[model samples]
Target chain A: MAGKDDDVKVLGVVVSPFAIRVRIALNIKGVSYEYVEEDIFNKSELLLTSNPVHKKVPVLIHGGKPISESLVIVQYVDEVWAAAPSVLPADPYDRAVARFWAAYVDNNVSTVLYTVLAMAMSPKLFDEQLLMFPGMAGVLFAATEEERAAKAEETLAALAQLEKAFAECAGGKAFFGGDSIGYVDLALGSNLHWFEALRRLFGVALLDAGKTPLLAAWAKRFVEAEAAKGVVPDAGVAVELGKKLQARAAAASTAA
Target chain B: MAGKDDDVKVLGVVVSPFAIRVRIALNIKGVSYEYVEEDIFNKSELLLTSNPVHKKVPVLIHGGKPISESLVIVQYVDEVWAAAPSVLPADPYDRAVARFWAAYVDNNVSTVLYTVLAMAMSPKLFDEQLLMFPGMAGVLFAATEEERAAKAEETLAALAQLEKAFAECAGGKAFFGGDSIGYVDLALGSNLHWFEALRRLFGVALLDAGKTPLLAAWAKRFVEAEAAKGVVPDAGVAVELGKKLQARAAAASTAA
Candidate 1:
């Protein structure tokens, strides 16, 4: 096992909201780490070896041992740092609630949004490939125009649920857990930048201010927060990247 | 908010492995609690109000405040009890690993098994109804005989992964997290009761001793462990319940 003095490195991609989760966690905990960008389309050798299971981004390598899965990494950061502004609540019940919602964000918000984006950018990939995989596969498939519209409507419904949660969970606080941004906040907030880009790229409105005022405000506060400002990828960069991926996917399908 | 002195009530079903999770948690913690079995077909007002989102069983009512989701409830029990034998490891990486596997068990093992079971008992429920829902819905679906057999093969493959995990993660320990049964253990262990019934009901072996000796051994040890005694529902009971549910579902479908 590597010693305590060993390095801390994060393998990530700017477009991936999951990677942003780790970046935000590290930033909030005030822990310094090397952030290495990975080409998700063609994963690096290090990423492949580091996270052999998912082979996905947001792998945090601390002292040579890599930890994958964004929430798992976030929890690890909170525990290892063991500092103030704890990511999860000190109370067990509170922590349970926090964990539930974070899982909810992953299940309801993140995965669904990714499916929607995949449908828009790479419909063939969405229907023929990604849908067949296990766990949240092809959940929001859009094989037809009507199907696409239905999925878009579903996204709005999902956002409405989150908006309801913000009203109920926040209870007059600025953040979900009160005072400062906590676990659920980071879990959801970290994805907002990339989600914003998706919104613009797809010409869809998910979290409309009129529909979800609280969530709209919360997203603004989260992205603009001092800790998150420099860490999160800019929306413009995200939009450009999305367009590039779209063009490339189209070309790949055409060539095939 | 209810005070600390309020009653601890667990709303669960006798056959649900998730309810077993809460039972094991409370049993391990040595916390006194009342168990209220819910009629899932007609959820109680209390259960519905407690967990308005899922309306599922395994709702932990502590001091009248309800906490839904089994894993969340288990974590809460470990934290509130906060005594000897920590539910997860102290090391951040270890905890992350445990969390990941626990999530994996939920994502892969539990969901897949439930889908298979639903397919067997109520094909209509599994197809038209469950398929319509979002988030972990219609995943692991098998409409035809060939599809079901393939899914069974997939289940075996999933168990093999768990067996591999036991070897890699445990490093010759009796449990996943080491000396005592930890978070991941409970995450998978609690399901053994329901799984046992499924094995007998479906006439398939997921944790075959010849194939996954480690997992097979772990299942025996988990069910027979003194802490798990009486907390986990009996396989006999589960089988009976499964049969009754299948009959009822068949009758309902015929009526429709």
Candidate 2:
């Protein structure tokens, strides 16, 4: 096993959800590492050099070799520090389920969040922004129109599944996985902020407290946890950013 | 490790890229199992009962628990028969990189292939199809237009990295990681058949012999190998299917 102080550094942007997922995972495991903030507008030399292929942030550099991709990085961190609180489930079936949902959240919810963010930031591209939803909706729901409408009728079905899984795993505990927060929580929690922000920005709610009470409560509980408390963006700030993004979207559309 | 059995059943459609990936992996490892062909048009009750969440094929039923998803099924197979040729590398870092690429291929390449398949199947929906290309191109190249163009100019640069990795690992051998094909090769090799079909379907090509000589050669070498020979689709059949898919795409677009 690599030593604790083997120059473990994370290159990331403060506002990035991808970066935050890694940060939360590392924090929960109590792994000590240096954090290097990268400016997306003007990426650092290290960021570019480290992740030459992707050249994106949230590159975890250990000893010299850099690992890119947020989900991949999380798995690497878990495997490298196996003795620490394991992020993945021990059983193969359970682990596969975890991965399936993680991939689902990444492909579906994350894409939706990006669409919402881009729309909020630049509403002038409303038609273009609307296209993003169909892909996401296709994944969340079934491919057919009836299936999509059914899924919309039960809007929070996917989120509800996560909440049930969380409750079962949490067992009345604070975190998603018993005592400490696990990988699933970390991935889902960051999206909670975006969901809240999107609701305010669009004035169309997706995950309501009534519809998905468990998930809504879990989101609140996750954010309020000690590990995540100060790290997350507040609802007010998120709303303000959401409004700014919407205004920008409108302006861009008008200009176009 | 679970005992090997002739009774081991795999429910999958031969044409499915995801199913074929697992099929190739199983054949590579010399794992014996019964293959149950699935009809995607009208899914069997067993598939629905087995994978209620996804309701997709490539479901490997061993003893009882059905494993869905090609990658997950690959891992499960590897775990069950510990003595069989290991698909994953033993070293943590190498394994991480291999896993990273496998996940990358699963997430990105698979999606691109779908879009490409869609485009080939229906030329009339070309405009709708083109919309999907930007995201795929962005990942393959760079984010911005200028950067993306530069990246395309250096397309072989990324392919070179893959080629070098394969060559070094294979050591002038047929398989990726030596005498027997390993996980990385299976993850990559599965795509070769589809690429071959696509080349014939569409006159324009991506993985040319001149541009990616090693990879192009590897594709031919892989299909001819004893392990991969049985599973690869015949050229005649693929062409017919491609034409049918293209016809379907045209009809759907016309209706739209």
Per-residue C-alpha lDDT of model 1 across residues B1-256, encoded as one tens digit per residue: 2234259999988767788878877876667789898876667899889987666778998887889888888878877777646777777777888888888788667663354344444555444343222212122233345644555676677678788889988899888968678888888887776567667876656668999999998888888877788877777986776666555544545554
Docking class for candidate 1: acceptable
Over 4 Å off, model 1: A1-6, A112-141, A240-256, B1-6, B112-141, B240-256
DockQ of 1: 0.47
Say which docking band candidate 2 falls in.
acceptable
Which candidate's TM-score is highest?
Answer: 1
Error of 2 at B203 (Å): 2.2
TM-score of each: 0.85, 0.80
Per-residue lDDT of A28-113 in model 2, one digit per residue for the tens?
A: 66777788987654678998798765677688888787888888888888888778788887776667667666765665465433
- Using lDDT as the measure, the top candidate is 1
True contacts kept of 2: 0.23
